[model samples]
Target chain A: MSRLPSVRSLVAALAFGGLGFAIPAVAEEPALEIVGMGSFHVGGRLAEVSGQPPRDIVFTPGAPPARIDPNGLYAVEQMYAQWFKPRTERGRVPILLWHGGGLSGVTYETTPDGREGWVNWFLRRGWTVYNSDAVERGRSGWASPDVWPAPALHLPVGNPFERFRIGQGEGSYSHDPAKRRVLPGNQFPTEAYDQFPRQLSPRWTTTDQPTIAAYIALVDKVCPCVIVFHSQAGQFGFRVAQARPDKVMALVAVEPSSVGDPARVDVLKAVPTLMLYGDFIEQDPRWPTIRRTGIGFAERIRAAGGHADVVDLPAAGIRGNSHMIMMDRNSSEVAQVIQTWLQQKGLWR
Target chain B: MSRLPSVRSLVAALAFGGLGFAIPAVAEEPALEIVGMGSFHVGGRLAEVSGQPPRDIVFTPGAPPARIDPNGLYAVEQMYAQWFKPRTERGRVPILLWHGGGLSGVTYETTPDGREGWVNWFLRRGWTVYNSDAVERGRSGWASPDVWPAPALHLPVGNPFERFRIGQGEGSYSHDPAKRRVLPGNQFPTEAYDQFPRQLSPRWTTTDQPTIAAYIALVDKVCPCVIVFHSQAGQFGFRVAQARPDKVMALVAVEPSSVGDPARVDVLKAVPTLMLYGDFIEQDPRWPTIRRTGIGFAERIRAAGGHADVVDLPAAGIRGNSHMIMMDRNSSEVAQVIQTWLQQKGLWR
Candidate 1:
């Protein structure tokens, strides 16, 4: 793949618009060429429920009674995926982006701070992008409470504030900006911190089987492709790769919270993998243990004749990143790093 | 705007691919040019909650206690919008699509049966499309129960089957396809009927204020535009137009369940409106009342020197449509009718 130095310069120019008068306007750059774009749902099964009471309810406040027959066949646990095919291809395979828990494909679409997200960034670099909402999340429908009885877990505002490492530690977050204790050189834009939660969906603990099945089906449909998953999807990425090593060209796990079964590490022998973590992981309450799990998995993969690279952003000299590295201020630079890695691995055409 | 006959032919050729061996390959057509595409969140206020219990919980099954600090200024009620700008423009203004209750912007996207949806349909017709998820739905974050209080309403699988007019009557739907009583000449694809609920979301009763406020904000952001809203968003469409009559060039309400305030009907005097309804409204249990309300509002607008056209599809020679007309079997034909109406009204450039 030919590296476009001009695109990087154009991004730099747009970042510092007025200060750099010598730089050309952003409009002068050739528009990103998109050959095709569409979305589809994958996985899910028809489930039948019986012995439920038939109730008459109003859809609207004062509308006539509409009978809701609970005993019927319901389609449940399907995942949604939207794909954008670039006219100019660079990667040998498409890049499938899977989001973390309590989130959907929106995580890869646009940043909470209203900036271009990784999906667009990678697409601009000449890769077909497939952004998906996991089962029971976003456009992917949820099952009835009877089918999946557990209530969806919610992340309170302060939970991510401290857990994501945007704040220094527990109790570091506050309603007032002045009182909120942000890390000294945090890469996250705290001004738009509140906007982050807008992308979060209610997550369930019992839907992993359906989620994995859906993801496998997606891989079966469009594979020999790379997977770029984040946080909770880390385990999914690894497990999917193990399930179909011939299909998964490479794996990029961004701050993965969990790893796959160590027994299946040998299955990923041919899949080049990158376990990418961000700054403040060493100091965060739970990240240290989570990072170790990822590291342990990486070590296991390497022992099994697989290529696994554990990259701590701070050690790599890219600092101040929180758990949400993809949404960080230097997100594009980080994306470029991944792009370069793919090229080195000979995955980029 | 010039209507490209070849594009329509291309769609037809693809639809009947094997039957028409004489037609050119789909790749022969020029790719759809997208100059820009991005998304953003809008319209939410910081709501502070106090006197809630301080509980410790695990985000994951085995994770450590993440303190849930409930007393704080939490950002809620924000709506999310994603826009696609076609390289070539045909409409004098953009088209803003608003979805109904129990659904998000996904309703305007790909159909449950895996066909291109209205967003792409309009974009292909050269209109810049802006699809939005209303407040407390989809990518739009929801407020804490302490703030909004009321539980969200859910549509059981059978609710839409009969209510949307896919089934013949109240007890027409059954789990088994053979046993089900689908309406004769039903436009909905019953095989994919199960897929429709995938787009349904948990909608709250108490979020109308914030939802309206957010939609108004969206209108304020991209205006002098046409709004095509469906179902529950009908009230929002009319109310927003009333709030900014000059900005809303035209309004389309497809099977809108409710109308705007009767007192503010005069505010829509300058906005040309279309209250479009599908088949079975005359015989449906609740649709007659709902349709009357829409027709009544249109009459009020006309009496106030405004132009409002109420078109019933079956009367207009297009039959077998459900309330979800956008996803019906003849959805493209329905879109064409709307396009023709806009062209005749001088909304198209």
Candidate 2:
């Protein structure tokens, strides 16, 4: 394999003292040399609109009046994916990084604090990366209220702070930075916590059918592939893997909030899977039960003669994590753990 | 200056027969070598929400109850920018590409037909590129309806058909492919018109303050720079340039539907500007008036002693262009025109 020495890799080599594992450093890294980059949308349906009052308005205040005819065939419910192919291929399959609910592909692009994200990390490891914004989020445009029915949900600023384990507990967040409480030894950069909300997107309660169909189409377009999903997208990773077992080579669920259909768990038996849980779950209001359910799902995968490893960061001696593990300060360390697993599964070339 | 001989440049060199000007070719091109790439958010304000009913719901079907707290100091109205820095800098200033209304930075990304968009077009030319999703769009999350009381305006799929000049005239669109009417020589990839609606985003009618503020903040972050804006962002380009003439080196408005503040047009005296309009405007219901207003804005800039050129594409011998010139079949040709103009202005290295 042809490898161009990068400052990041050099720093990683020095920090690891010749351990032979390239650990990423927390720094602005050099641009990558890749074969190409592009984007595409998947899984949209056309629906017609009618019987709405026409409104004549000036699109530009001084421009001529244009009629907004609220009646036509509209395209709705598509997911968007942007892929980057590295110059050298070191992985057996491409890696699809899917973000959780209320977020988009930006979750994997750059950290809230402006640090290198998982997309670049895996790309540097010689894997083609397909980063996606699921249906109705970011580049994946939303449908009208007629189709989605319920209003999209927005995450209150304080919700994720306590729910994601970034703060001590409920009522721990404050508009004032000085009063905001961070969990003891928390890995998140609390100073940049204010920037975190910018990455949060409005998500709809209904849209799973379209979302899953999009994922299946993406898998059909580029696979056998590995899927690295976080939080809300955990269920999608499993469901997509089950739907296209032949295309999905591996699954890495990062603090997955949900799992696959219990009845359909066996279909993922042949797919190597990793379930990672972060710290402070025991103290949070909800994570404990969610983590337990994830464990049960993994056990079933193993019981079906498949391989699945559930790693609790605290138990593994890797502490100070939150539900937003990928955005935590020690994100690179956690990424290394998954890299090691992919290597062990012989998925890394 | 170090120039990497890319397949794109090679193809362009051949296609143009070595005219000494490199025109981009229509093909999937190689990845760029750059010093780095990253993203950041700019211009958000904190607003408190209260007196809202709290709801209990399952975030994931099997997860524990997570309270939906709709009340708090939520961050709102930030714009998102992802930048790519080319390895060999060619331009004296970076170029910021801002999208029009009802669209995100995806406008400058891959076209709806899967062709390379202007983001890569400029990046390949060695200009550091900053592609942005404006406030309340794409990666830039929206505020609650409490903050933005009006429901977002969505474009009915057929609206842009005639409005963008893809169809021959009003009522020229049909859901049936064979029945749809295209202008005599429309340059848009009409076959891919179905994919176009996927790029339309939900836009608020009353977001100019936060939108302009966010844009000004972005200008503060990355300037002296060139700004390339389209359609609805036309007013923003003029407003932001007027607000930061020192930082804004040049402004390129592609078929801008509006102009800057007439009272403050003189502030742009030191800033070079280009107003590009596509064909079929004279026959359109609104574009003729809109185009006249845009030309008037250019005349005002010239009257104020600022350098401004208003180029009607058809008059310039480039016919059959649409409002979405950047995504049209001859997008690269149009991009070359912009590039040539920049060169003449001495902005291009």
Candidate 3:
């Protein structure tokens, strides 16, 4: 029998130093063409709680010249979503990406490090990508503090790096970059780590109820979609899947803080769910509990004969990944991994 | 003074139904251009150990027609590397990427899920990117089985998925994809999970010595370089830095399975190091000890007045990342984070 090339021949080939083996030419394929692109608003109801009309607020002396027309502000919480359709769609269903807390659809547009985000990456992969700004966030309208109890909460400057595990523990952030204590192998964009706090939007502690309703409405409008929920949107995404199993083809939760009622997860049996967690969760005092609950819920779903897969990024060797997996430097790699999972489930054509 | 927009105005502006706000037009910059591209071989001693000559073996009458040339192969284990130089050269030092066990430079090319990997991503960020197949791997010539103890070990089909945390556990992989028991939140490319086994190359357990020598020679050839190593290459990467700290600007180890002798970490004080660990590490039976040792080594390096950062990805909110972070879905995200760190350290101009 003719055996494999002997090691000696292999070395002989190497003896001819600097001669690069010709790379075989791969057949080039057409680039992904954007066949359709559009934006739309979903999930809003006009509230007649008051008969107040539009009024103008005039600035007083010493204040910079300003006039504000504050009308039916916060009367409706409409969520906005933009979509890009690939000319040749490879996925059987559209992907609806929901942002995490204190953020909006912009989460998937450009990374904090100023790189192309996952939306375009997914598009290039022949997917119909839908990026949504959930209710009270981003392009989505928020309820007025007068009506919806808006308590502006600003994240501490150092919190993102520390809490997100981009930097080391409490002493991680510093005015002097040289003194900053980052995780030795942190994958966070530390040079731009300070820029993150500026990106945070004011969040209200009591907006959960309305947010869920608006999210559900958006789901009703776009049924049979693959929902990718990030952070705070995690619970809402799971609830949507549970509420209308037929409407949600699958659920991909990216570091979801919570999920639907664990006792009633049987409803999720029909929807294949994939929960992905990024790095540094164990260090977060709050995430451990969240992780436990999420794990319990997933186990319940699986026990109920559903496809519930849990992905822990750190365990997978994708080290130093931050909470914002979508905007991460290696987001496309994560997206590719998710897409592969979708294909395995036959969700992707 | 005119203060920032109130939460009400934010909501009001958001309420203008269907009136999409004009996205700020960001000034477009010129695309990253590659100024030069080249390939080279480095580090192989001329072996006068044998005087064996070349010979051709003819097939027997019953055997299929074939003529095999068996000659002086494994005589040299020169490492091969290709580089792309960004026109702008934003980064001061070139980045050298080394792959893990049984893998080659391909690890940093296209990901397992077929996405643009960190190689091009780094180049776009204005850094010179060098992708190298270490000695005896890929374009680097393999030594003869006679000189090197080559073990014909075929990885059990299901093991990569399981051991690598792509699949759930020992029984996670199945011929029936549906039967696979992957970690619940795994971010591995499950759809293309099966493709991983086919990509694996047979590795020798006894190749460590030559591998280290070849790697050191490469370092000597390309001085003052930043080395990014993954898995099995981790220890070698560390040793190279220790042997010639002057030649290595920095070291980034992604989910290293092992590293150099912890006792000698003091020598690494001058070479800033980053050790990144991805998801599900605690679940791996052998990783805990490896992690402990690495952490200890890093501590020693830091105590010795060196910069050694240890990043646990899961803690950073990047969950479900796999061992193959270089090829993971968020590989670019991880790379961006590293680039930012390098910038902060004044390593990237």
Candidate 4:
């Protein structure tokens, strides 16, 4: 029943005090790969023959086929660390945690002294977070994305500006985010003052939504899965749900800023949807409020054939949500709610 | 004395009938270069060389003594299309517009509308914007970040999950964010789920900060400049100022979210600073209210001999102040405040 190696075995296999990790071999975890899909320009051209076949495979949250790469080594703090160890037996469906704007998936979650992050929350919960940097925001590595032979890292670099400069700022954490990160390709000097297009567009957004669709397809393949959207990412999740209702087993929306009228979605299925919010909503302090819109939104989602309910929790006592929720002070409680909800449905925690 | 050609000339040069230009470059735009400095990995061994010598000589902002690609032709969107001819020629201080999270800086003025961005706002008032994407968020193209390249686009190719792909049938916008646009290096599927190391990091956030610093140094050697911060990119502007203060005349922080207490900076010298916030703020509702810490943050800067002020606008009526300040109802007022501040001080514009 246990396809995953013992935790002791993995710890024993890892190099603790060095800048790199050396693992003997874990028959439990296989390497992750994407067939012949190499460069975008060439990948587009090679699609006919390779069918985008992966040379090897690994495991990630919300990913399909449950491929695991036990040998994958990530460099953190100059020391190579194994960031993830996927369970080959598919212990449990992964949790897709979508963080809010200006934050990485690690977000507001940190150690008690405010130094640690949420890498462990899902790890202990028997759920894979598929956790990485918020694209260009975290320490998921991958600094130079345009280098030909291939980019070095493929994870978040953490907030490049103020955040990355801390001690042991290797990977994306060393780069600055603001001046350095903005527009994907617009990395030139402003003959006129302009902000972005630094370069590197993910396949999910912009004129193309392959990312959004691919995610839903993933959810469909990994049914009985739950997705947690934090802040601005809530809007993105809503957009996905609107596009494909059947793909989602349940949705845990935390302080979502945008929830399109679910009524507009005809295919919207009746899933166990939990829309949670903080009491400290932001707005004009007068005219329209978060509750008015949020409640209406919840009602709409519920009416649209989903078992939806808006749960307002006590404040985490932070300065602002900043569009982040999962990592808030009450994250434990939030986790419990999610677990309970999923368990209630016997969807497997 | 004109370093750049005019719109009419650009149109004639391109000879293309699209008033609104896309990626295709026009000869009129000083040979638009879409080159970018992505993650160090993507930049490969090329990044270190991009910041050649004397610290400021090779990699200054506007124009460097030595070009990273001296004789190379790079593709660019020709950022700041709305207001360059008037400002640069006038020798006005350029306004550096750092972007908010999840958005490229090009849309600084309005929320992806066809209007000028915040950078353009100052540009219209005789300032320049050195906007660059963080890394992989916008159209900025990137190469495979893997040690070995692979094709993942079979999923995102002809991405059909875009926001506008409504009623497109099953799997329309179903391309997975995790599997689709991801570069080749992502062997750890755990982090790849939900399509991560986000295009959010984009290139310029770090690799280009120095690139931009190089540009700014050149621009400053010729003309003084000011820094502007909006949302997530706030910390970035501060970092740039820290890297080079003499070049930056002042700073205008609009509804900034990062750059906590200002006492932590020694890299930047004291300068006139203004921190603006929208009355309509975004809140988690469940989190304790986080005041605009940048105000006191500015005070700390002032205490350290730097000048800083906190100015709160009347009901900004802006939705997602964390996201939309430059495009809010009070955007014109925001522009006016900046213009007035610039004009009153006789700082170039």
Q: Score the docking of each candidate (DockQ).
A: 0.35, 0.59, 0.01, 0.03
Q: lDDT per residue, candidate 1, B1-349, as tens digits? A: 3443332343343344221112122343233666678887787887778887876655543345567666766667778898887778988899999998888888888887888788888887689999998887777756656777765555666768877888987878776678889888989888887777766776766677788999998888878899999988878898888888889989999988877878988899888887788888777878898888888989999898888877777766678998889889989878876776687577776
Off by over 4 Å in 1: A1-30, A46-56, A70-73, B1-31, B49-56, B60-65, B70-73
Under the 3 Å rule for N, CA and C atoms, how many clashes does model 4 have? 141
Q: Give the worst 10-residue stretch by lDDT in candidate 1 chain A.
A: A17-26
Task: Supply the global lDDT for candidate 4.
Answer: 0.38
Candidate 2 stretches with Cα past 4 Å from truth are A1-31, B1-31
lDDT of 3 by residue, A242-303 (tens): 77788998899887766786767888888888887777777765567667777777889989
Model 3 per-residue lDDT at A10: 26
- Which ten residues in a row are the worst by lDDT in model 3 chain B? B58-67
- Pitting candidate 1 against candidate 4, the one with the higher TM-score is 1
Against the reference, the lDDT scores of all candidates come to 0.78, 0.83, 0.64, 0.38
Model 1 Cα lDDT, one tens digit per residue, A1-349:
3433333343343344321112122354334766677777788887777898877655544345566667776667878888888878888999999998888888887777878889888888789999999997777757766677776555566767887899988889886678999998999988888778767676777777789999999999988899999988987898888888899999998988877878889999899887788888777768888888788889999899987866666766678998888889988767866776677677776
Model 3, stretches more than 4 Å misplaced?
A: A1-349, B1-32, B48-55, B58-74
How good is model 2 by TM-score? 0.92
User: How do the predictions measure up, each by TM-score?
Assistant: 0.88, 0.92, 0.45, 0.33
Q: For model 2, give the TM-score of chain B.
A: 0.91
Q: How far is candidate 4 from the true structure (C-alpha RMSD, Å)?
A: 27.6
TM-score of chain A of each: 0.90, 0.90, 0.83, 0.49
Best by DockQ: 2
Consecutive 10-residue window with the lowest summed lDDT within model 3 chain A:
A58-67
Clashes of 3: 67
